[model samples]
Target: MSQKPAWLTTDGAPWGRGRARLVYDNPWIRVTEHDAVAPTGAAAVYGLVEFKNLALAILPVFDDGTIMLVGQARFPAQDYSWELPEGGGPLGVDPLESARRELREETGLEAAQWLPILEAQLSNSVTDERAIGYLATGLTEVEADPDETELLALARVPFREALDAAMAGHMKDMLTVAMLLRGYHMAREGSLPGALARAMLS
Candidate 1:
């Protein structure tokens, strides 16, 4: 076996945090500024955005290679975006349970099978925002109950079409993009059922 990198075996040197002060706070996030020293021994200032919840995303796929997408106007981007059903789970709650609620609320779909596919840190350099992505299959439809703050549009499209659109820049949500790629990898790697994998890749 190849030897592991020395850095991977232990925590190396860390940035020196001198002083930290909360600059802003809200129910959803908190911003803090820090006086710090970089790993290279350079003096620097750092700002961190701390999230109050964990990010969750769900890719709802039907057995025949179709997937569901949700569209909404995003305030930060100031543009309408099409993405997988996604929302925030309270920090200590089971992410899958929160994902289930988001999928149902946004798309009115529930899955008989669920696979946790990806875990990532979103904008790690500036934020403590982390995300979990799920591949949800064996779908059944029900009435949607979106949150009052959400005005969403739902679409069902071929899985490959959605993946291609994301690749082509039509879909820009990072979580959505990452999950689509992960699903494609799973299908191509035979991690999914043979029929489903064929349907997805086809």
Candidate 2:
């Protein structure tokens, strides 16, 4: 008789997966379909999408409490999107480097200070897409090198007005919306510099 591995513990068991098959794959994502045995002893099948990169977002705030937003037409949905500077970094690469590159590429702004603001899973049920957001300050202008596929328009808006627009549904990109709200929270909670926060709220 064969013995189960000691490292495989069922102490707080939920579900067990059976055989898995690769359903689809691409450079960016892969889909796997597998059989699963639920904790209730019910059988189920799961289709999982795995992302090959980490999503990185940067919210660049100028000293005057204005944010740099990028407007472009997003595909599939075929709608115009106003979003924070965002891009993908290889999974194992340092995300900050990706953030710096993306911010520069999109807005031609570089920051001396970068604060980690948010870490989250974008779609837990469907895809293993992870995201990280940063608040960037001490900005200086540089030359922008936008992606070939992007036709970007830059907008500098007051923090409060941008947040209000997002809250009113004018901005629907989840990362942008979340970061704007978080910036507001930081201002109210005194997590940011008093003058800067006041400027943002004002």
Best by TM-score: 1
Task: Give the Cα lDDT of each candidate.
Answer: 0.94, 0.92
Task: Report the Cα RMSD per candidate.
Answer: 2.3, 7.2
**Candidate 1 overall lDDT versus native:** 0.94
Residue-wise lDDT of candidate 2 within 77-184, one digit each (tens)?
899999998999998899999999999999999999999988888978778899999999999999999999999999999999999999999999998999999899
Regions of candidate 2 where Cα sits further than 4 Å from its true position: 1-13
Question: Tens-digit lDDT track for model 1 on 18-131?
Answer: 899999999999999999999999999999999999999998889889999999999998999999999999998999899999999899998999989999999999999999
Positional deviation of residue 2's Cα in model 2 after best superposition, in angstroms: 47
TM-score of each: 0.94, 0.91
Model 1 TM-score is 0.94
Task: After the best TM-score superposition of candidate 1, give how far the Cα of residue 30 lies from its true spot, in angstroms.
Answer: 0.4
